[model samples]
Target: MSSTFETVAGIMSETADIPRETITPESHAIEDLGIDSLAFLDIAFAVDKAFGIKLPLEQWTQDVNEGKVPAEEYFVVKNLVSRIDALVAAKGA
Candidate 1:
């Protein structure tokens, strides 16, 4: 797993009460892990703190609301890992 995946899995484990062992790239935050909206917010906060990068929360929500991206895609572990990798690379660059 990538470091981004590890970080996200750790955050999910803590915030969503899901076991790290069960967290895979295909895991769905809500369907597989039972993460509710409130828990998702907490996970987002934790991710921001851990990575020292601010997630584009407003943009993500707006995109979903505007039908740009499926709302469920936001909670996919692989998608989150990819996003985090992009953010980290952009920050470094």
Candidate 2:
């Protein structure tokens, strides 16, 4: 697995109390792992601290709330991994 996926899985493991083995690229944060909105905020904060990348939590949430971004897009593990990897690459660049 990519470091981005590992880091995200680790955070979800702790925040959602789900086993690391159970977390997969296709896992849905809300449906599969039972991560609520508040837990997601905590996960976002943890990701920022762990990777030194800032996720646009407020903006993303607003977009989702306003129906601009689908809620499922935000809660899918693979999608989050892709976004984090992009951010990390951007930071390194």
Which candidate leads in TM-score?
2
Tens digits of lDDT, candidate 1, 1-93: 788898899899978888889999999888888988788889989999888888887788799889999866787899988988889889999
Give each model a TM-score.
Answer: 0.88, 0.89
Worst 10 residues of 1 by lDDT: 71-80
Segments in model 2 whose C-alpha atoms lie over 4 Å from true places:
none
**Per-residue lDDT of candidate 2, residues 1-93 (tens digit):** 888899899998997688999999999888888888898888989999998999987887899889999977877899988988888899999
Q: Global lDDT of each model?
A: 0.87, 0.88
* TM-score of decoy 2: 0.89
Error of 2 at 88 (Å): 1.2
For every model shown, the clashing-pair count is 0, 0
- State the lDDT at 88 in candidate 1: 80
Off by over 4 Å in 1: none
